[model samples]
Target: MRNSDPTLPPGAPPAAGAYTVPRTDPATPDGVGAVPGPSAAPDRVHAVASPPLVTHRECPAPHVLPGCAQSDGLSPASRYGELFVDVQHSGLFADSKTFPDCIPNCDPELIVTRYREQRATPGFSLADFVQAHFTRASVPESHYVSDPASTLHAHIESLWPVLTRKPMAHPPRSSLLPLPHRYVVPGGRFGELYYWDSYFTMLGLAGSGCGDLLLEMVQNFAYLLDTYGLVPNGTRNYYLSRSQPPVFILMVDLLEREQVARAIDFLPQLRREYAFWMDGAQGLRPGHAHRRAICLADGVVLNRYWDDRCCPREEAFLEDMQTAMYSGRPHHAVFRDLRAAAESGWDFSSRWLDTPAAAQPANLGTIRTTAMLPVDLNALLWHLETRLAELCDQAGDADAGDYRAAAQRRKEAIMQTMWDDAAGAFVDYDWCRGEPRRCLTAATVMPLFLGLAQPAQAQAVAQAIAARLLDQGGLATTELTSGQQWDHPNGWAPMQWLAVRGLARYGHDTLAREIAQRWLATVASLYTHECKLVEKYRIEPCGEHAKGGGGGEYPLQDGFGWTNAVASALMALYGDVAATCRVDVGDADSGGQPGHPLS
Candidate 1:
C-alpha cells in the first residue's frame, strides 16, 4: 500500500511513527484509511515519532516540557488527550463514540517505555500494550426502533441517559474543566457539549419537558464562558482555539423566556462572550483585521470566523497533516483552512474556498475563511447585540445604549457590505478579494431570522431563496453541487429552521409553510425507512434511492442534536403535513418582526 502523503517521494517511507495509510478504495471517506501493516500497527505508533517524546514546542499549550519556564504539569486527562492523538493515528476513533474518552489513564512515561519494548520484541504488538495499560468507556446502548410514528420521540426520551454524562472522574480530569452538572451530548461520535448544537438539542429537551436538563446545559455554557473566556467549540481542551457559532446568546434568551428571572443572571456571561468575538475591535483601524472582526474598506467593522492557532487540529491531526501535504501551500495556510472551517461550523465546505467548482481535487488551501465576512455570523452577532441591549434595558443598566449602538452599527454594516442589491439577496464578502462571493447560500436568511433585514430586503431575499435556493428536500445550503456536505443536495436542520422562521417574519406565509412542510416530510419519510434522524439530509429530490447524506470529512451521523430540536420545534408549531400546509404563515409576532429598533 502507498503511504498517506501522495506528495512524498515514490518509495520514501513515512515519517517516524506517522500514520501510513495502506491503499484503499478511492471512493471511501477521507479519514478511513487502509489497514496498516502488522509492524506499523496503531497501538505501536506515536502521533509524530517512534518514541513520541514530548517536546516543549509540540505539547499542547500550558503544558510544555518541564524544563520550559512557562510549562505547567500536564494533567492526567490532557496526558490521555495527547496519547489518544497518538495511539489512534490511523483515524481509528474519528468515527467512534468512545474516541473522545480515549484520554490517558496511566503514566505517559510508562506508556512510552512499554511502546518501545513492544516495538523491540519482533512479534509483540502495541495494541497489546494498550489492552493491558489503558481503558475506554463504552457507548451507552439505545432502546429505540425504526418506526416513524414513535421513533423520534422514543429516541429523544430513551437517549437521555445514554447522552448524558456525569462530571469527569477525579484521577483523570477531563482535558476541559469539569462540568457542574450532567449534560446531554449530541450522541454518535460527538460526545461533548457542542456550542451551537446544544441550543437546538434544548429544543427537543424543552419539547420533552426536560426543562432541568435545558437549564443545566445553559449553565454549562455559562461556566464555559467564565472559565475559557469563550466557549470552546465543544467541551474539549483541543477545541479551545475556536468556537462554533455564537449561539450562547440564543440559549440564554430561551432560558429567559422559560424562566424570566434567569435573564439578569446570564447578562454578564453574554457580555463576556460578545467581548470574546470582538476581542480586537477597540484597536481596529480602517482596512485592518482583528481576531474575528475585520474593518471593511468603508471603516465599518464586520465579523468573520478565525482561530487563534495555526497548527493541525489535535483531533483530526492525521487528516489535517495529509491535507496540508496535498495543498501545495505552506503548512500554516492549511492550518488556517482547518481552523477557519471549524469557525464556520461547516467544516470542509466549498463555501469558504476561493477556487471555482471546476477546480479539481479539492484544493482546501484555497479556503480563505479569515478573509470572508460571513453574513450568518454577523447576523448572529447582531442578534446577540440586540439581545444584550434588551437585557440591559430590563435591568435598568446604562450599557443598553452601548449594545444598541453596537447593534445598529453592525446592522448598517451588514446591509452595506453583505446585501447584493442586483441579486436581491445577501452574500458573503470576500474581504481578501474585495468583492461579493457571488454564491447564494442559506446563510443569506440569517438576517431575516435575526430581524435585521428591512421589509423590502427581506422580501427580495425570500424571492431569491424560493427561486433558486429551495429544493425538494427543503433548502440546499448553497446553489452549487461541490460535493461538500454544506452545498447542494444537502440541507441541514438549523438552516431549515432559520430560513423557515426568517420567511415567516416577513409574512411570506405560503412560502414559509411550503419549506416547513417539505422539510418535515423529508424527516418523516426518512424516519419511516431509517428510523433515525441524521445530521444532514439529501433534499435535492433526484430519482435516486434515498441514502445517507454524503461528503465532508465524516459519514452521516445520527443521534443528531439540531435535527431533533428543529424537527421537534416544527412539529410542535405546525403538526401534521395537512395542518402545516393549511396554516397561514403571517408576520412573526411584534417582537419577532424584523426592522424593529434594536431590541
Candidate 2:
C-alpha cells in the first residue's frame, strides 16, 4: 500500500539538486558505574569535488574514518588554540559555527603560524586575517521548484533531494565529520545529521517510504559511533563537547523493526555509547555526580544532561560568553550549565533555570540544567535498559539479567524520586535541592510514551497535561514564557509527537486525537501561508492565530526535517487531515486560548 503511490515517489526526478529554501546519542543500560568510526557495509562513495584548500580544525576526520578516533579525544580549544579564540571573539561571523565550518585558503598549520606572527603587528586585524584565510561556509540555495499551491505533503516529498547532501569520498578540511553515504540535513543552517533528531526524522522517512535514505542515515550514525566513540551533537568537531540526548537506542529500534533483523550487528556500538554516558558512574558516591550520571543521597543513580568542557560552545560562542559574563556564578560553571541545557534539547527553559514561579520568566544566566535530573532523560534511559535486556535475550547473551535488573532499579528510583504525588505529575528532581523541581512541561508525557508509567501515574499525568500543558494548537513546551523558544506559546514537533503518542498509549484517545488534529491544523494554516516548514510553531493559539516561532540562538529555521517528518508520520498514524484542516481546525471545545496560554 505504501509503495503503490509513495509520498516520495520512486520515479521522482533524479536529483540535479533542488533549490534552496528560506534559511532559518548513544547511552548504555542502567548501571552505577564510572566512566570512560563506522564499521559498516562496503557502500562506498565516489570522491566529488576535490578537497577545498583551507585551514581546518586540528581534529580533521580522515578520509577513512577509523583513523579519526584520536580527534574525538582532543578538545577544540587545544586543537585550534588562540586561533579558535580570535575567530569567535573578533566577531567575524554572526553565527559562531560559521568560521569553524569554513574552508581555509591554505593549510591549517600555515594559518596558525601566520596568526601568531601577525596578531601582534601594528596593523593586524583579526577580522581581516580571518577573511583572507577562510572561505565562507557553504550555504544551500534554492534549486528545487516550489509550487505555491502544492499540498504540504507534496512539498515535503519534494524536499528529499533538496535536503540531501551528495555522497562523498573526500571531505573538505572543515569542522564537518565525513559520512560514507548521502544523508539528509534538517535544513536551513543545520547541514549535518544530528544524534536524537534522527529518530523522529526517521519516523517521517519511514512513513514517506524514503527507505534507502532512511537506512543510509542509520548507517551514518553507526559510522559516527565507530569513528568518534559517540555521535557528537552534530557531524562537526565543534559539537564534540556535547550531545543532544541519548536516543541512539531508539534509532536502533527503528532500524530493527524496519529491516526485520537482529540487533547483534550493532550491539558493540550500542554498548559503547551506553558506556560513554556512564563513564564516571563506577566510583560515584551517594550525593555526588560525575559526567552525565548522578548518585542521589539515597544511592539511586540517574542521568543529567552534560558537556565535557567547561567553556563556551563553539556554535554558541558569543551567546555563551555573554551568559557567563552576566551570570553571578563562576564563568566555568555557567558555561557548563549552558552546554548542559543545550544537551537537554530545550536549550533555554524554566525546567533548567532557577525561576521564581512555573510560569514566570527567568534570565538565561540562572540556568542550572546539570543540577537537575530530568524525568524524560531517566525514562529514556529506562527504555534503553529494558530494550538492551530484550536485545540481549534475542541474541542469547547472558548479561540480559543484569540489564533487566538495572531497569527495575531505575524504575523504582524514578517512581520514588521523580514522581510528585502532590503535583500529580512526574517532575525533574533537583538533586541539589533534594526535591522535585515541579516545573510542569511536556516532558511529563515521556514516561507514558516509553511505557514506563503505571496506569495510575499515566492517568495523573494525563490530567495534568489537559489541565495545564495543552494549549490552543498543541502542547506548549513548558509552563513558562521566558522569552525562550522552548517555553510557552511555542510547540516543537518532537514534543507534540511525544505527547500525542504517550496519551494514546495511556488510552487517552480523545486528548490524543484532539492534539493530533489541532497540530495538523496549525501546520496546515502556516504551510498555506508561508509555503515552508519550520523548526517550531507558535501553537499556543488556534490555527488562524498561530505564528512562526521565535526567541532562540538563531532565527526560525525553514526546510525543517523533524517538522516535515513528524507531519508525515502523524498523518500516517492518524488519517491525513488535509481536507478536515482546510475546513476547520476542530470543534470549539478542542482548545480555546486561555488568558495567558500558560503551559
Candidate 3:
C-alpha cells in the first residue's frame, strides 16, 4: 500500500488557515511512506510544492473548478482538496491579506476549520462572495453575475427564514379535478409563450425559492424586450403586434430587491421597457382643456391592451365597426378613438364591440367615444413612476427628484379624477366622455393599495369591496353581468392577493382575513385534489365548468406561478401577525360622516 498522492486521492490540504479537504481513498495505506528508507528517501526530504493558485479571473468558472472534472484524472478526495486549496490561495477568502504566509499543505480537517472561521467573520456576507466570483458573461448590459457557489449561499441565507417557519399545507380535496378546454386551445399559440402569464409567474418564482427559474424568466423577458422593443402577449407571430399590460417595471422591482447593484446596472433597459407602455401617450395632445395631459378628448387617460400593427381579420372587422359606429369614420381617426372601446376595465365589453347603430343609445356618447382611464392602470403607473425615480436616484441620475415629484402629482391626479363621490367606490373615468363608468371591478380597489386614496375613500372602497366584490373564497374581478372571464366570476390568485393586501393596508384586518382564509382554503382544496396550485378559481361554487362556460381567449390556465406565490405570502402572513403588521395600514381614520368614504 502506498501513501495517497496529494494530487490524486487524499490530497494534502492548504497550509494552515484554509478550508479542509476530505479524503476520497480511505483504503490507501496511511503510513506507507511515513518512514524514510536509505534509498527511497533522502535524509532531508523535501515536500512537493502544492498546485499553483488560480486567480478568480483566471479560473473562468469557479463554481465548476477544474479539479472537480473527472477528465482531469484526479480522485474525488484529491479534487476537492485541490479545489479548497485553490479557493484559499486564490485570494477568494474573506481576508486573504491577513493570511499572507499561510502554508499550502495541511490536513483536510484543518482546512475545514479555517473555512468555518472565515464564514463566521463579520461583514463577509455570502452576497459579497458571489460578487467576487461570478462573472456575468451572458448579459453584458444586464450585468447578471453567475457564481453558482455564491448564488447558492445567498439563496440559502435569504430563504432559510421562510423555509424554517414552514407555512400551513393546502387542505385536502378529491384527486380528480376539472379543467377547461381553452387552456389547450389549438392554433391559439400566441407570441413568446404567454408573455403576460410568464411575467406574473416570474414574480412567484422570485418570491418562492426558485431563484434559478426566476432568473431564467427575467432573462427571457429581457430577451423579448431586446428583440422586439416590448414583450408581446405570447411568443407566436400572431401575437407580435400587441403587448400585454406593462409588467416590466414590476419585474424590475422584484429583481432589484434580490440584486440591487445588477438591477441598477440595467436601469437604461428598464427605462426603455417603460417607454414601451407609454409609447402611445408620448406625444399625444390633450382631449380636455385644464386636464394636465389628455389621453382622450372627452377626458379619459387610461390605456388599453393592444397591438398597433398586423390586425387580424376578426380584429379588423371589429375596429372598422367601432370606427363607423362611434366617430362615423375609420378607427384610425385618432389614438383616443381606437382605444376608447378597450379603455373600460371591463375587458371585451359588448357595448364597446357593438356597432354604433346597434349599441344602446345611453352607452353611445362621450363614454363610448372617449377613452376611459382605469383606476388600477393609473395607480400602477404612479407606482412605476415612483419606482423608476428611486432607481434613477440610485444610479445618481439628476432627473430622479423631478420624476418622483411628477409621480406624486400623478397620484394626486388619479385620486381626484377617478374617485366617485356618489358611487361609494373608485370608478373608471371616461376622460373624453367627462363622467365615471360607475361599474364595480377589482380595479376599483387599486387606489387603496397605491395609497393614493384618502383614508375615507379607502375605507369606503374597502367596504364596497367587502359588500359586493368579496365572495366566499376571494374577491371577484368584476360583477357577474360583465360576462368577461378576465373580469367577473373568476377570482384570480394575483387579484385575490392584491385585495387581501389592499384591505389589510386600510386596517380592514377582518376582511383581509376573510378573503385570505377563503382563498387559502380554496387553494388547499385545489392543491389536495390536483396536487398543484392553479392560476385562478371560480368563486361562485359552480365548480370549474361554470367558470369555464364563458370564455374568449383560452380556457382557464392552471399551475400558475403568481397563485403559488400569493399562497406562500398569505401563509407567511397568517403564521406571523408581526409580519402582517409590516404591511398594515396605520392610524389613518376614515373620513367622518360617511355611508362609505368614496360616496
In angstroms, give how far residue 78 of model 1 lies from its true place: 7.8
Least well predicted 10-residue stretch by lDDT in candidate 1? 27-36
lDDT of each: 0.66, 0.70, 0.45
TM-score of each: 0.81, 0.84, 0.55
lDDT of 2 by residue, 1-599 (tens): 01111112332321221111111112112223331111221121111111121111122343464433222222333445667765665556767667656766676778788988888989888888878987876655432456998888888888877877854622455666777777878887788777777788888887777778877887887777666566778877767656777887877777667773445677876776776676677767987777788987777779898876655676776566556554555655666778788888887777888866544447777788877889998998898888888878888999899889889989999999989998878999888778788679899988878888877777787778777887777778997777777888788999888887877776676777778877887787787777777889987654454577877777678878888888887777787763155233322122211121101
Better of 1 and 2 by TM-score: 2
Which whole-number lDDT from 0 to 100 does residue 452 have in model 2? 82
lDDT for position 117 in model 2 = 89
Lowest lDDT sum, 10 consecutive residues, model 2, at 45-54
Summed over model 1, clashes come to: 3
lDDT of 3 by residue, 429-461 (tens): 665446677667787777666556677776777
Which candidate, 1 or 3, has the higher TM-score? 1
